[model samples]
Target: MAAFNLTPSDPSTFILNGIPGLEAAHIWISIPFSTFYVISLLGNFTILFVVSKEQTLHKPMFQLLCMLALTDIGMSSCVVPKALCIFWFRSKGITVDGCLTQLFFFNTAMTVESAILVTMAFDRYIAICDPLRYATILTNAQIAKLGLLGLIRAVLLVLPEPLLLRRLPFCPNRVIPHTYCEHMAVVKMSCGDTRVNRTYGLVTTFVVIMLDLTLIGLSYGLIIRAVLRISSKKAHRKALNTCTAHVCVMLMFYTPFLFSTLTHRYGQYIAAHVHILLANLYLLVPPMLNPIIYGVKTKELRDKVGKYTCRM
Candidate 1:
């Protein structure tokens, strides 16, 4: 066992972690991940292309969908490329600076995705529950404003994570257990007191997930009530149908997220890896499903995407 000194007087050193003696590292993981990455990229790109080419999709709902696609593209690109490199080349080494950069962008993109989903829910709520005010309430200007706010929130939330991590004194172990640089993963490697970082992380998690979940619940609750108030059975069914896809996406996106956070904190090593897997699902599943979900569920989007593709 080796001990690392963490003092200004001594030179800094880092310890890398890996299996003690593995003859051949496995390469199989990259196959599925790479396939998923390609599909994710093509899927998200198609959504962006469809939305951009169709002038009719220039509404608030589609605008938010476009933003969601962008966020998913960024999230997958940030993690999967590096992960594939590691798995294919058997090169797990990463510079401290590189690690920090990875954490920053990953965090930012993930935060932005969460915010965009919430905004999308709000857009849907207004469209269904308050049809008369939908146009005025979610004007193009307002949609742009929401997008801008998502960007700003992402930037602001991540600024403190790196700043906080940079200040922590590191243990010699430089290797992260998982593939990517998660905020809590880095924080746990610190030799110094990490109470502040943990507190901040918890607070941010609550603000992002709990608050967003509460709002989503409220928005849907109102939507359900609105649906019930519609006297016509056909109209009620249609309104509920419009929300079905969104509800599915929301459950898939948030349930895994919450489970990951909770299990990662208190569960065993295997549990932690399962949580990591779930977290990846959050990034990949919603993006892959969004366009398909919206396409089948919303006739407007399906028709618009079809018309735009026909022009090509």
Candidate 2:
């Protein structure tokens, strides 16, 4: 799947040797990514397995975790393989169509992840703020509906990105700066006036991320209010403990996201490497840390994972 407009010169057309120190940097990229992939795979897979095999773990929070693990797998799938191939295997050039496809999935996974994180927050809010009705509020049927809705919204919300890219013309200089087909990176290559692309991209980013943040914040705010109302220090501690994983996970995603955007505009190529480093870590770190955080902090997931693993 070559770019419709650009002819491939060679596999090395986009290799990093041209950049100063990039040849040496490739080794750094490859090693860290390789290690992260292993950890992410193991952690996410264990979470998925734990949630799937144990009926006790089938609550709304774990349900969201499973959705998150699935999204993490998709997110890693979108970037890691191509990145590894580029750095380790020296397979650099990707067709424009291939780039578009990758961008779509990456964007989709990102949007889906934001929604999943929000859903998890809502789940926590319900459990903490309305303990008695938690079961009724987050029944299996309701969780399933949320899962399906998240998937649908993920794919549907980001549809405009790739569609808009398809209409834009790229007259020349089809080489993408980064290894994978990031939306902004791909847009920057367009020969056409990219005001529309920039508008859509920035708007899309703000809309999705801000919306997710608002909902998550609201849920957390209510949870905090409810926790404060409860006088037991032990109960307050327990409630905060449940939220720790989600809070860490949200910060992990949002901080790098905002930094990457800032780096994109102000930092240019110099920030690009940093953005790539952050993006890779964003996908790998959260997934790797998520299950560990949950298993360590949430006793039920931990015990279920241990019990299921022992059985296997």
Candidate 3:
């Protein structure tokens, strides 16, 4: 049997590229990617593990942290393992169904991650803005409902990509120039007119990203406003201090994402490898850094981590 079933009506397989025009460096490059992937897996897993075991940590904020950790694990696992296989073992063949599966899960995880961040921003907003009513506002049930809603929104928005792609006919050279099957990367392989795919993708991305960022920005704006009202220097410092981890995570998550989106839309003059690297970073950086940021900046988590590690 052929490695890739080349059929215009229904291509059976797709090829993945480690990094376009840089196959020689793929092995060496996998070093850092592998490190990020491992750190991401372990760090996020640790967050989940510690949060789940500690009754004291079962609050709304920590619950959101668990959700974020789960999203990170899902997103990272979707990309890095397949990428590692490409870089290490030279296994780049992915079936159509498999590619679509990867596409959906990756997008779903990303959507969930974005939505969770917005919720985290809201959590911070309440924590800073209305401490007296925080508990009343964000009960445990409400937090879980928000998490579930995020998953639902992600599923509904991302469902069209694969379904649309599956309807189109794929031409020959069904090679994806990136490590994993991205929605657009896969869509561009179709011989059919992908106006619907392109339009929906652009709209969905802009709507989700812009709306999330706008809400996050509005949230911090309010947070800053509330923080400014603190009468004491220590109180002001404390308020800002609590938000430092969230702010760091937000930057860590959005900066790479913004760069990648801009590069995709306008940085055509830049190297293909640059686009590939940025895209991977858009997913990998946050997962690897969010836990570390929280661990360092959140005193509760830091103290808990210290105690846990000391016991180990």
The number of the candidate with the highest TM-score is 3
lDDT of 2 by residue, 43-97 (tens): 8898987788888887778888888888888888888888887677556667667
Which structure is stronger by TM-score: 2 or 3? 3
What is candidate 2's local distance difference test score? 0.78
Q: Specify the poorest-scoring 10-residue window by lDDT in model 3.
A: 1-10
Question: How much lDDT does candidate 1 score?
Answer: 0.74
Model 1 clashing residue pairs (backbone): none
> What lDDT would each prediction earn against the true structure?
0.74, 0.78, 0.87
Q: Point out where model 3 deviates above 4 Å.
A: 1-10
lDDT of 3 by residue, 1-312 (tens): 343344333357888977998999999989999999899998999988888888889899999999999989999898889999889887878889999999999999988988999999999899989999999999989999999999999999999989998999888878889999987788778889999998898899889999999999999999989888888989989888888888888888777877776676678799999899889877788899899999888778888878888998
TM-scores, all models, native as reference = 0.88, 0.91, 0.95
Q: Which portions of model 2 show Cα errors greater than 4 Å? A: 1-21, 268-270
Candidate 1 per-residue C-alpha lDDT over 1-312 given as tens digits, one digit per residue, 9 for 90 to 100: 122232222224222222213214436556667777777787778878887877777888888878878888888787777666656664556566677888889888878888887887888799898899999999989989988998898889887988898889887656566667777877887889999998888888778888878888888889888888889999988888877877887777777777777666666654544566666666667667766787788788778767767978
Q: Which prediction has the highest lDDT against the true structure?
A: 3
What does each candidate score in C-alpha RMSD? 4.5, 3.2, 2.1
The candidates, ranked best first by lDDT, are 3, 2, 1
lDDT of model 3 at position 197: 91
